[model samples]
Target: MQPAFTRERVGVHAADMVHGITAVTDAWQPGRTVDVSAAMQSVTARVTARTLFSTSIGDQDVTDIQHCLVVLFSGVYRRMTAPLGLWEKLPTPGNRRFRAAHDRLRGLIHRIVRTHRRTADAHDDLLTALAAAHGDGPGDSLSDRELCDQVMTLLVAGTEPTGHALAWAVHLIATHPEVEARLHAETDRVLAGRRLPELADLPRLEYTGRVFTEVLRLYPPGWMFTRTTTCETELAGRALPRGADVLYSPYALHRDPRLFAEPGIFDPDRWHPDRARSVPRGAFIPFGAGNRKCIGEHFGTVEALLALSTLCARWRLRPVPGAEVRPRPETTLGTGPLPMLAHPRAPG
Candidate 1:
């Protein structure tokens, strides 16, 4: 529960999709880039199961976990948005399902923990990391409940954003053939068809990262971060009031004409650190900058880059016929129909 979602899990988590891509690619044998949404799903499921439970799960378990996530998120939103006088005694079927999801997730994780402890070969995956990371910090580890809660958090947080980001990246790359072509060229130049893109390949993937940055800007997975005022302070010269709820909207910030030369255009080069330096601190926050920013930013970024680069290293995505990619705003803005198709990239 107390395990800090660190950079380490990305490698283990990546193994899931790398396998999925190989399986999918071999089946289609496409010569151009193959859209790897199915592969992305595999990675997302793997991250949730492996990161939280420190175990592997089947396709059905992954599907069940996603269903649980939907319920849990909906329940949270309902509780937050419910009327003040609503009775707690009344629980709907949906709430029941939600709680069941929560319970199932908890039960599954603890069983995995117990199983791992019993086994001699408990490998150094996230569960192993959590087992080793026992004390809260130095001498403190999480309690069983805390571990379950943290695992639950990872199940939801680890999946939704990365999944949506993958979808967005695919849609963006698919529709913009020029951008897609550039990405294909970039991955080829950087990796030269080495088995898969590794953490080592990330530094060489500057523009690939920018594609993610720009995509995050235009379609941020964590679209709006909200906070209630614990202490009053001025923001943008506005007088602050205590207890005021505020939202930081990256969508608005990313598209502001004053900050971007052409906000609507898909331009990864704009994120070149030299050019990026000019944007105001709060204005450029795709992952939210500074202390209170998301813990998963770097982790998620790396995961997305690896997934995108790995998939692009082999397959191409193009628009699906009659499919409209419209933004459905919820916790994250998901593009509906995910309007894309995958084809294999011919070797350069």
Candidate 2:
């Protein structure tokens, strides 16, 4: 059976407010998101690094891991549509890149594992925890190959949607100032000038949380999610054949008027408690549902909330010169090749 979708504590989100941005703002604060994509990469890189490598893999290693992610992300669509035989030509450029990236990622993880053995200190990083076998052994412990697979899974999943989600959160909040104002109000009211928001503060950021929920409604990072049916079943009384590919898209579903009132508009109020509490479990499924739901939902939202509050606290984004916020409906939802104008506002 597939695992259930539950919230996860993404390593990068909580930590980046300290490690990545503070450094940038103190020393390298540019007035624009000139390298927003690169920033996304940096954030995801740190998350993956901290999660798996802990003490062993450094910034350069993170870059290589990001490269593998790019290789796989760039080719995922091609693989989905390419003919099996043509796709299997192992020497294809993208496949070759994937192979190289996969190797580098695995090598980095192994090196980290070796280093953890030498230290033998009770380290808290995910990889060190995995390396030492935290719970049980063999029957319960992960093999080296499983270790590699988990690392690969984390690298691919930990980075991509999150990176994209971070980028979109910036774009969405920047473009919608009313929404931005409300967002600030909620954060300011709930956070109450407290020491930076933490896991504990998450529940208090309800409206800010809905800002993410609404953003997910408009341009969810995981726009098109899929699953293969295992047994014959009926959804809305429509017969679904077993083994058939079931493509249930949050993007399409969220826009279906039958599922949402005025389904075409972007309104955070729609997610207000009374309304949100009433939403059918599957009506808006950006993170997906059932056993295969997103494991990092909590972590991703927390990361976004923290980062958005921090950035909005500092800068106001205006459309940049020669740039517009355009949606690219790639496998994941994202802004176009061109980023939006996001000139930081003077702090009030």
Candidate 3:
């Protein structure tokens, strides 16, 4: 189900994504500080909405869904760190708000599902594909509730991490002029006055790709993940009990000095082909590893690359002076309100 749609149908949505991000960036006036972090979220959300559910960014339904998502995730950190887990069920103000948000979000998703079932056609979106899959077979098909779950999962998962990654990428590019210059050089040379990037241009946009790779390495949205041992095992000559939960943090591993030289610095050239292969195994798992890895990985990568290429080709985003930039690690690792000034780049 994932491969058939994510790999094959992504191109159909790529053009729309490019247009969406381009419009967002084009609206920015020179020398004005724009909250790129917010813009990135809006852009990714819109792209994922249109591609996954055929929902328009401007629609009130989309706005409500987005707002509900914000409220739903607002308490994630508290939920994660809560000792007894009683806070979640209690009708405190925060919990009440979360419950309300979750209900609204579910209602929106279910409404969209019903609309799709009633009005869907040969449209090339994930919802359409899932609906068709459910209608195709007997026992193997997903139930309506399952369909809603998948839709919600895709919208939430596909939007947030990609949005944060793009936000970090913009922040990195704005702060590092040398990296930014090289990125522009590659894009300008490859684009050659072309307005939008094609899939083929991805290979030649080496520097831009490396920039994104480094960005993910430094600021992976999925910073840490957990694994459980099904059977008792030994690691590094130490015994481990079955059902033991092991936590691995990619954020820490990526920045380990033992693994990467000068790990704290933002260096896109570290990903140059020759040097990139020298990294040790299990040192980098941004999206994740094994079968549970993110299904939207490729789609997100393509979307981010296109966004960086298309926007950086025309405008240079500079971080607003004295703006406090820091990671707001919650359910997902994110940057809070990255303010940046946009300047139009001279045509090459």
Task: Give the range where candidate 2 is weakest over 10 consecutive residues by summed lDDT.
Answer: 1-10
- Note the Cα lDDT for every prediction shown: 0.70, 0.66, 0.83
Clashes of 3: 0
User: Model 1: C-alpha RMSD to truth?
Assistant: 4.0
lDDT of 3 by residue, 60-111 (tens): 7766766776776677678888989987888799899988888888888888
Residue lDDT tens for model 1, 1-348: 223455554555556545533543556544333344444554676655655554444556666776667567657656656688273336878767767877886777676566765662656555556555554567687656666666677677777778788888888887788888888888988898684887788889988998998898888877788887878888889988999988888888889999888999988888898999887767877677777777777667777788788778776767767766677677766664453555766646
Cα error of candidate 1 at position 169, Å: 0.8
Error of 2 at 83 (Å): 1.6
Winning model by lDDT: 3
Q: Which portions of model 1 miss their true places by more than 4 Å?
A: 1-17, 20-41, 53-64, 70-97, 117-121, 128-141, 236-238
Error of 2 at 309 (Å): 1.1
Candidate 2 per-residue C-alpha lDDT over 1-348 given as tens digits, one digit per residue, 9 for 90 to 100: 012112433533366534544433334344544546556655766665665565566777766666667767777767667787587467877688767766776787777666676775756566655655645554777667777777777767767777777777767676688888877776667657653556556677777777777888877888887788889988877998998787767888888887778876768789887887867778887778877787767666666677666655555555566675666777677674434444544333
- Ranking of models by lDDT: 3, 1, 2
Give the poorly placed runs of model 2, Cα more than 4 Å off.
1-13, 16-18, 21-33, 88-96, 117-121, 132-140, 186-197, 236-238, 338-347
TM-score of each: 0.81, 0.83, 0.92
- Model 3 worst lDDT window (10 residues): 54-63
lDDT value for model 1: 0.70
